[model samples]
Target chain A: MNFPSKLIEDAVTEISRLPGIGKKTAVRLALHLLKQNEVVTEALALAITRMREEIKYCQTCHNISDDLTCSICKSHRRDRSIICVVEDIRDVLAIENTNQYQGLYHVLGGVISPIQGIGPEELKIESLITRVNKGEVSEIILALSATMEGDTTSFYLSRRLKDSGIKVSSIARGIPVGGELEFTDEVTLGRSILTRINYG
Target chain B: MNFPSKLIEDAVTEISRLPGIGKKTAVRLALHLLKQNEVVTEALALAITRMREEIKYCQTCHNISDDLTCSICKSHRRDRSIICVVEDIRDVLAIENTNQYQGLYHVLGGVISPIQGIGPEELKIESLITRVNKGEVSEIILALSATMEGDTTSFYLSRRLKDSGIKVSSIARGIPVGGELEFTDEVTLGRSILTRINYG
Candidate 1:
């Protein structure tokens, strides 16, 4: 579309470069910014730039942090002996939202994916191994997705850590709490039955 | 959600302020930006900031512009005698995308919504009158939406422009071209029957 102003066109062009944003959505967002107060735009722009420029990752866990070590990894109350390994910072946030876990996280940055040319070396696997070598951690939980890449990463990590004698576990997969068995997929259904827990 | 970093929380807070973006999507987008190279975020932030700070509007039509008059209003190829009145700059972009119209446009900025405390005085109705008083225009099209506010604005403008001797018309309303008859709503179907046209 021919924009009446180059600034709007340029803004839309840049915004559409992000994941899942199309030209139309970018246009809508850019125009919304135009309708808002300058302070709003200023704050948004500043926040984005500051995040990209000044944001740091935890040296210990590779989670998003403004300091050398993330808050979760540094907190004495958190269970340092159990590390939950996940794909990225968003997964850490998701797990944190459940309020079900109080352990430190090891952000692998991404999982093993041959399709995208990403492998174990592309992730922070070496750092994870280094943490495990310290021997303070007793158990490591693989909290990655159920996708092929997630499974591949879990397998590789388990094999590598087998010699180290640390227990490696994965999050259980079953029907979601509110889901019906009739609607559950075959693989999950089969696994749910095979991994059934003993009744109390 | 507990963010590992304050900067991440701040960024998510600001990004989620846009329309339709919630806290979850904002966190996803913020993390996506973090995963990408710094230049991506830099470009996005720069484009938004530059657009908001340096944008200009057309003096003649009140549309977005980089200079005094917009390109369309200044173009000799477009029909200056015809003006298509619209709600805002997005409408101008939408109509332009059709590649069907070759007329000038006057942006009213907004519709008459008493509930929202917006009225004729709050919009560019006076400026539209001023444009018509120049005596250069012969036809004015009411290319606004088909809502109550749009109809009220059109009626008010027509009443005010009765003495100008300029032809005024609105775009046709009926079932959308590819719309199914069974799914068409009552108002549109009723209007289609009432405004039946002759076919040779």
Candidate 2:
């Protein structure tokens, strides 16, 4: 479609480049921005650019932080000996939201996906191994997803860290809290049965 | 949700202020931007701010434009004698996309709606009358939607322009092409029957 202004078209093109946003939504969003107060656009632009330009990953866990070490790693309340390995910062946020896990996080940045040409070398796997070898950790909880890539990363981590003398464990495979038995995937259901605990 | 970094949280807060985005989606978008190259963020920021700060609207039609007079109004190929009245720039785009209408447009900006405290004075109604009085040689097409506000605005315009001696006509109402007989709204169906034209 022919836009009346080049700026509108350029704004739409830039916005549509974002993940999950399409050309039509981009147009709508750009027009919406136009109708809004100028300060709103300014705030959005400033926030995004500031975050992208100044944001840094934690030196210890690779999670997003303003400083070299993340807040989680610095917090005295968190269990430094137990590191819950995760794929990225989103997962860190998700696990933190649970409020059940008191352990610190180890963000891999991403999983090993050969299809996307991403391997262990591309991720923070070497740093993770170093963190393990430095040896203050008692247990490592593999909190990655159950996807093929997640599983591959988990397997690789387990093998490399086997001789480190630290106990490594995967998160439990079980039906979700409110999920129906029939709706549960076969692998999770079957594994839940094999690892079933005595009724309390 | 508690974000690990202040920058992340601030970015999410700003982004979620958008019309349809939520806090969760905002966080996701923020993280996605963080993972991407710095240039992407810079470009997005520049585009949005530039569009907001520099964009201009046409003096004649009030449609968004890069100049004082929009391309549509300045086009020599378009019919200068006829002007189509529309609610906003989007309507101009929709009509232009049809490629059937060759006339220029007069954007009312919005229709009359007392419920929202918007009236003829709140809109560009006076300018439209002024344009008509300035010797528009022929027809003025009321291309507003068929809602109450649209009708109210159309009625007001017709009464206001009646003394100018220019022909004022609304767009025709009929069953939409490829629409099923059983699923049509009663008002539209009744109007279609009352305004039926001969079929081949």
Candidate 3:
């Protein structure tokens, strides 16, 4: 079937590329964007552009930020001696929203997924090790997902840091199998944080 | 609760403004964007910017275009004498996808909704009348929604065009109540087009 103009089609295609967006939904969203006022559309565009141009991965935690270090790392109130390691930045937000954790974060960028060809080298594991080796951190919280990849990464990190005299603990098991922390409701995430158990 | 940095909050808030998006979903989407490659995020931003800066309403048909006039209006193959009246540009795209109607389009910008404070003057009805009065248009198809607002606009237009001796028709009644033409499958829309009835 003949589609709308190429520009419209292109915009739909790009929107569909976003996670959780399908082709039909993308078309609907693109049309909605077109229907909106020019100012709203421009704001959306600017948001996307600024996300790419202005934001960068924090050199220390790997969390997204507008500066060399993420706000959590730069904050004086956050305890630098306790590092909470996570699979991605969303986990950082999930942990932060609890208002429980006062420690700094270390975003792994992703877990060590063998099936997806991702290894420890592909992650921010090296940076995490380097930070731990600096000798000030007393606790390392493994806040990765409750999945095989997350388990593997946790095991690998614990083994690597076995002699570092640092306490390594994984966040608790209330998070469902195959469920992402980002999608889990805040209360459940809070409970998981409150009940975290020692790993190693 | 202490949230992530203000930048992260701002980004999520901006994403939530899109249709059907809520705070949680917006945060998920924004986090995804944050994790994505800079090139992809930049492209999304540029698309939004281009849509705002480049797109404009066609002076004649009121359909959105990147230039002075829409491609359909500028094309020589489309039937200029037959003007298909639609409620919005999305409807124009829906009809265009069918490839059955080669006629020109007249976007009302919206239907007549007295309760919502929309009136005949609020639509592009005057421009439609002016176009028909210029004497080139042979047929005007009222391809509006079957809702109360759409019916009111169709009735108003039919009465206005009655004395002009031009054939004014409303697209067939098989369209479901409160159903937008853009959401109807192509076959149904085409059938509705084929079964249009003459208006007084």
Candidate 4:
């Protein structure tokens, strides 16, 4: 598409670099910003630049933080003896929203995905090991996704921590709480049956 | 959602302010940026800021431009005796991409929409009239959309230009070029038959 202005073209090109946004959507967004108040654009630019430049990763858990250590890792009320390991900071947010877990979290950043050129070295596995080796943590909950990469990361971590004597457990994989039995996938249904709890 | 950092939350809020993007998508985009190199975020922020701050509007046509006058209005090859008016700058780009029209363009910025509290004064209607009154133009083509607001604006412009002794026309309305007749909507099909063109 021929842009009337080079500035708009450059803005659209930059915006379209983001995941899931196309050139058309980028154009729409750029035009929208143009229509809005200058403060709006300034605020957006400031927030993005500040977030990228100033945000830090927790030294202990590798989670995104404003300080050296994340709030979850620093909170005295959180169960320091149990660490929930996950693939991303968003996962930590999800589990935190559930309010069922009070444990500190270890953000792996991503899982072991060979297809995407991601391996154990690319993640925060060493930091997690160091955290576990401190011996204050008694159990490690593998709260990663159910994908193959998640499982591979879990297996790799378990093998590495086997000699350290700390218990390593994975989150359950079964039909969701409200899922219909007939509609559930075969593998999930089988796992649900295999891991069924005893009746009271 | 509980953001691990205030900066992330701020960035997400700003990003989600854009049309068609939600909080979840905003968070995803923010994280994607965080994962990328700092130059990516810097480039995006700089492009958006520069575009919003430095872009100019064509004094003659009201289209977006890098200078006082847009390239279309500045070009000597374009026909000065004709002007195709549109509702937005994107419309100008769309018509230009067709390569069929050699006339200059006038961007109205938007059509009249009372529901959105937009009035004729808010657009570039007065400037269009002023351009037509100069007597250099003999034809004014209304290339606005077929919506109610578009029609209202077209009618308003025609009324304003009725005594100017210039030909006022609108782009043909019918099914799209590649559209199938059987699946076309009744209103479009009816209009297509009513305004059938003569064969050469």
Candidate 5:
């Protein structure tokens, strides 16, 4: 059967690409956009466009930023001596929202998974090691997922940083198995951060 | 606590404006965009930008279109003599997906609701009457919602078109009350189309 016009079709297709948004949901969303005031729709579209055009990864923490260095990395209020390593920037936001974490972040971009063909070299692991070797960071917090890939990356990083004389730690066990840090509510994430344990 | 960066915060705020997307989902979507290849993220952003920049309404039917007339309205295969009136473009799509109706469409933009201050004047009722007055159309189908407002609009239109020497019909009653056409499965919508009844 023939569907909507090509423009509507394309909008729905793009919206469906987002996580958890199926075809029906995408169509609903697209129609809602069409129903909204032109200004709101324009703002939403412009936001997506600006995100791609203006935003870039922080050179130090790999978090999203409009400049070379993210605010967390540049801020004097944050403790640069403790870096919390995470698989993605979503984790950084999750932790930041809790208003608990005072240290800086190190987004690894991804975990090491041989099956998915992602390895240490593909991540920011080398940069992390270099940062640790600088002798400034006293604690490296592994806030990666509890998945097998996350476990592997954590072990590899711990072994590599063993002789760096810095304490290597992982966030606490309140996070459920296979649970994404993005899905964890702010309260649990804050509690997990406060009760972190030593990894080595 | 201090957040990651203003750029990340702004991107998340924009993403959250989408339906069903909360602050957390927005952050996840933004992070996913950040982790993706620049080309892919740029493509998604470009799609949104183009949606705002390129898409426009069909002057004839009011359905979303890139040109003056939507594809369905422009197509010679569609029966211009039978114009199906719907509440929105999404309804037009649902009807099209059935592959049963071969007629053109007229999108009303919304239904008449006294509570919401939406009246016949606010809808495309005037344009519909004008289209019918041209004498080329023989049947005008009301494929609007089954809500009270929908019924009110249908009754109002039926009264106005009583002497127009054209048949006014409505899609069947099987459509659940308050259920949006976008959510109705193809089969149910198709069946409703097949079971349409004369309104006036």
Candidate 6:
């Protein structure tokens, strides 16, 4: 589209570079910023640039943090003996929001997806094994997704840790809390039945 | 949702403030940016901030521009005698893309909407009238939307320009080029029939 100003065109092009945002949405967003207070755009630009420039990855867990080590790994309240493994930092945030898990987390950065050209070596699997070899951890929980890649990564990790003497476990698979039995998929329903626990 | 880093949280907050973006999408976008090269984020931030800080509105047409007068208003190739009035700069781009309209544009910024607390005084109506009184323009095309607010604005402008001796017209409304008659709304269908022209 022909833009009246080069500045607007450049802004729209940059905005549409973001995932899931197309040119139409980009134009709309640029126009919205134009109509808003200059301070809003200034603050947004400052926040994004500062985040990209100053943010660091935790040297231990590989999770995004302001410092060298993330708060979770540094906290004494967290159980250092048990570590939960997940695909990325978002999963860490999700598990943290639940307030149920009190253990330290190891963010794998991504799963082993051959289709996407992501192998086990590309992830932080080596660092995780190094953490486990420190011998302080007693339990390793595989909290990856239910996808094929997640299962493959969990299986790979289990085999690698088989020699270490640490107990390996996985999060349970079942229908969601509010899900109806009739609406549940066949594979999930079957797994839910197979893994049924005794009522208290 | 809980964020691993405070910088990520701030960035997400600013991104989600944009129109049509929610917290979840904001998180996804922030993560995507984090995964990309730092140069991408820097360029995006710089483009947005520079656009906001340096862009100017056309003094003659009120359209967003880099100079005091817009390229369209300054161009000699465009038919200066005919002015097409639009609600915003996007409409000017749309019309220009069609390669059908060659007249100059007068962007009103927005239409009159009492519900939105937008009145004619808030728009560039006075400047438009001043341009019309310059005795150069012979016709004014009301190229606003089909909404009630658009119609109200067009009616208001036509009444204001009644004594100026300029011929005022509106864009033709009917079924879209690829629209099916069976799926057409009754109001538009009835109006199309009422305004039917002789067959070519």
Best by DockQ: 1
Give the Å error, residue B79, model 6.
Answer: 1.6
Residue-level lDDT of model 2, residues A1-200, one tens digit each, is 77889999899999999889998788888989999999999999999999999888899998999899989899999988999999989999998898899998899988999999998899888888888888889999999998899999999999988989899999987999999999998999998999897888
Candidate 6 has a DockQ of: 0.78
Candidate 1 residue-wise lDDT, A1-200, digit = tens:
79988888889999998788899899999999998889999999999889888999899998889999889988999998999999988889889999999999999988999999998899999999999999999999999999989999999999999988999999998999999999999999999999888899
Better of 3 and 4 by TM-score: 4
TM-score of 4: 0.95
lDDT of 3 by residue, B1-200 (tens): 24445566667777888888888888888878876788887778776657656667788888877666888889999999999999987788788877789999999999989898998888998999999999999999999997778888899999999998999998776568799989998877887888866697
Candidate 2 Cα outliers beyond 4 Å, as residue runs: none
RMSD (CA, Å), candidate 6 to true, equals 1.9
Off by over 4 Å in 6: none
| Candidates 1 onward: DockQ, in order | 0.86, 0.84, 0.41, 0.85, 0.41, 0.78
Candidate lDDT values, in order: 0.92, 0.91, 0.82, 0.93, 0.81, 0.93
Q: Each model's TM-score, in the order given?
A: 0.96, 0.96, 0.81, 0.95, 0.81, 0.94
Pull out the clashing pairs in model 5: none
- What DockQ would you assign to candidate 5? 0.41
Please give, for residues B1-200, the per-residue lDDT of candidate 6 as tens digits.
76768999999999999999999899899988888888999999989999989999899888888999988888889999999999998898889899999899999989999999999999999999999999999999999999999999999999999999999999998999999999999999998999887889
Q: State in Å the error of residue B4, model 5.
A: 2.2
Error of 5 at A9 (Å): 3.0
Q: Residue pairs in steric clash, candidate 4?
A: none
Q: What TM-score does chain A reach in every model?
A: 0.96, 0.94, 0.82, 0.94, 0.83, 0.95
User: How well does model 4 score by local distance difference test?
Assistant: 0.93
Per-residue lDDT, model 1, residue A103, is 91
List residue ranges in candidate 4 displaced over 4 A. Answer: A115-117
